[model samples]
Target chain A: MIPLSWYLILAAGLFCIGLFVVLTKKSAIGILIGIELMLNAVNINLAAFWHYYTQLNPSQTPLNGMVFLAIVFIVAAAETAVGLALIISAYRRRNTSVAGEMDLLKG
Target chain B: MTAMQIIFLIVAAVTLGGALMIATSRRMMHTVLWLVLTLMGVAVLFALLQANFFSVVQVLVYIGAIAILILFGVMLTRRSMVDAGESLVHKNWWVVAVVIALLFAAIVISIQPWGAAHTPLVELMEFKEPISDLGEALVDPAAYLIPFEVSSVLLLAVMVAAIYIAVDRKGGKS
Candidate 1:
């Protein structure tokens, strides 16, 4: 049987990977993907806690995690839409989507 | 091992693998394909967690809407959809070192057990009814009405901002 600790560890690993990607990648959409991955890690952690916590105790509703996760997911979607729009606009002006090339603000 | 656990493991593996591919891939189309797989895996994970409504929404909004928009951007901007993605980070190794340190810190914090705040888990008669409850909570006078409306407004603002920028690009306005 997979323990709750195992899920948490996996979630941690995924979160680290997402952070690394976000920090390293130059593409705006790529960073957005990393952000989504990080959000997924958080959602997984929440769901794992909900599952195990409910397993341990038998008096609380099991759907709290689901509800919270649903909200988070929606927020993530909204963030992605806005982020992509920015990316597209940037690409239109620069003719390239490379992150390092976007140095208009650099001194 | 319980079936749920087994299924969860499979979904996690798929999601992680897809995410890695998304990060490392150079081609734009390949990234979009990997994203689709990643989103699908996340949807399955949500289902396994009994968030059926969320699973549907994940598929509908993310896999359907956002992924398509990404591809659309790729096609509309570039002549071909297979440009080699540029590297953004400097050649210094210190960034990797810092990332590793931060990741270790996060893991340590997550694993620490200060005190166990216990709560009971009731056997819900309708695991699915919470979907309706959530819908009601979003609009109810005593619940999350403000947040719900605010989120919608935020989405609308994003939409307007997106259109403005896209059109401004054509008009040569910075």
Candidate 2:
């Protein structure tokens, strides 16, 4: 069994990279991809902890992490669907998918 | 090195490298491909942690569904399928590097003590199938029934909203 910390570190790395992409990407869909990456890191953490914690307490391994992870999967799929749909809608109106160009609500 | 350790290194490298490519790639197709690669790495990582169900979900949901959705979005929105110029916002590399370095350092330092008390694994894993437990938990009154029902409702609402927002009934041809 690998040390739990290694998984944690890897998740952290994935998250930071995602954050960088989110902060820097000009396209709205690119930002969405970054968010997916961050969510993936979170799922990794949840599963890794579940792995270790359940090992220590085999009698009482709560299914919350796994449940939450499954829920996240569903939510991510829905969000991606709606988000890209919105982006396409926005593209039709504004003729651009660039984040900076999406200033309709700007004061 | 142990087999697990070796697999870990390979998965982590692939994931991180793919993420880097996703961030830096100028073309949208490249970005989507890199995202797929990165998601696959994450799926392998889930398998490594013994969560075979999530690993499968990772592949099905992230790689199979989301990556294709992103590719379609990229293809549909852009006038040219190939976006030749820089698509990312011009960034100050030094500032981004400093932030990433700080974040990485904080995470590493915070987790350093956990390595000291690393628990050795039991020879045999007790629970083989977490998928069944998760299924039971979704419907079990004593468990997470509300959240499960709520997620379904949310999905329904999102589907409706996507149709509502995507369809141009008022402006364009129906």
Candidate 3:
């Protein structure tokens, strides 16, 4: 039987890697990828917790975790769409996809 | 170690390795490919956790829609497929690494004291059709209906917003 902490630790590592990519990557698309990874890590945490919670409380029907995760999926999809649109728009105007180079408002 | 534990370790390693590759891959196309690999590994983890619906959705939504969108973003943004001669990482990336390390340690320490953290999963019989329960819960008035409807509206708004933002506005100055 796999303990709950294993899932938590895996999520922590995934989230940290996402954070590293978000902070260090120079491309805006790379940052978007990091955000996706972080969201996935959060999804894993939610599912794992829900699994354990249902296990501990077998008498109750608690599907809230799955519902919440589904909502997150919606959010992730919406975010990716809007985010890539914004990136494309920025690239069109600024003529670059590098994050540091988009400093139009850096007066 | 047990077979389940061994499988978990292999999946975790593959997932983490793919994520690491996404961060380090030089070409935008290669990064997107790595993202696909990482997302697939995550989907497999979802299956291992017995969240089969999520595993399927992860593949359909994430890999099917999102990864392709990112690939299009890569293609539309760059004239060349490869990001040659460009520095991929920020100059102060070590600072970010130290901060992430501290964050990871903090998370591990915080999770250590939870009594539930050590507990193993219950038997499959205990679940009794969790997918159906999830479907019902989403539409149940007493449960997640509002959030579900709101997410639908959010998706509609996102579609409109994406189209508006990405449309090439010709002959417009400033």
Candidate 4:
């Protein structure tokens, strides 16, 4: 049986890597990729905690964590859809997809 | 170490490595490929956690839907699939690295003190019809009904908005 901390540590590492990508990637799509990674890391944490919680409280319904994770998944899908749409719209206008190059309002 | 522990370690390493590659890979197409690998690894982790439904959903929604969407975005936005002759990272990425290191250390330290952190997972409980339970909870008036309906509405709105935003106007510049 794996310790809960191991999962937590893995989630932390994954989250940090995702953060790094989000902070540094020059492409807007790359940032979206990073956000997906971060969201997956969160899903892992939620699943891990839920697993442990079920162990301690067997009588309670074990749907909460899974429910929350479902919501996160829904949100991730919407985010990707809207984000890519905006990116495509912006790309059509700017003729470039680089995040740093899309500064029209730079004063 | 137990087999489960070993498996977890390998999956974690692969997942994190894929994430690192996504961050550092110079080509956008390669980055999207790495994202698929990383997302698959996460789905594996979900299976390891005994959430079979989520494991399937992770693959279906993440790899199948979101990853393909990202790939399309990459292909559509760039003139060529290969992204070259441009800096992939910010000039001051090292600063961000340092900050992330501190953040990771803080997370580790904070997690270490929890009494339940070291508890090993017990044997799996006999969950009869987990999928049905999840379905019932989603539609039940008392549980997750509102949130589920709200999310459905949100998805619908997002779909409409995305179509509006991405469609080309007849008079607008292409």
Native-referenced Cα lDDT, model 3: 0.88
Give candidate 1's TM-score: 0.81
Off by over 4 Å in 3: A105-107, B80-84, B171-174
Look at candidate 1 and give me any clashing residue pairs: A57-B121, A58-B121, A59-B121, A59-B122, A60-B120, A60-B121, A60-B122
Global lDDT for candidate 2?
0.82
lDDT for B111 (candidate 3): 91
Tens-digit per-residue lDDT, A1-107, candidate 3: 78899999999999999989999998899999999999999999998988887777778876778788888999999999999999888877777788888888631
Ranking by DockQ: 4, 3, 2, 1
lDDT of 1 by residue, A2-48 (tens): 55565676678778777777777666666777787888788877876
What is the per-residue lDDT of model 4 for residues B1-174, given as tens digits with 9 covering 90 to 100? 988889988998899999989888988899999999999999999999888899999999999999999999998987722444767788899999999999999999999989889999866768653788899888999888999999999999999999998887755756
DockQ for all candidate structures vs. native: 0.40, 0.63, 0.71, 0.79
Kindly report which residue pairs in candidate 4 clash with one another: none
Q: Candidates ranked by TM-score, best first?
A: 4, 3, 2, 1
Candidate 3 lDDT over B1-174, as tens digits, reads 678889889999999999999878878889999999999999998998888888999999999999999999988987522444667778888898898999999999999998878887645574555777778877899988999889999999999999998888874552
Off by over 4 Å in 1: A51-67, B79-98, B101-126, B169-174
Mind sharing the TM-score for model 4?
Answer: 0.95
RMSD of each: 4.0, 2.4, 2.4, 2.0
Name the better of 1 and 3 by DockQ: 3
Worst 10 residues of 4 chain B by lDDT: B78-87
Candidate 2 Cα misplacement greater than 4 A, ranges: B80-87, B115-117, B120-124, B171-174
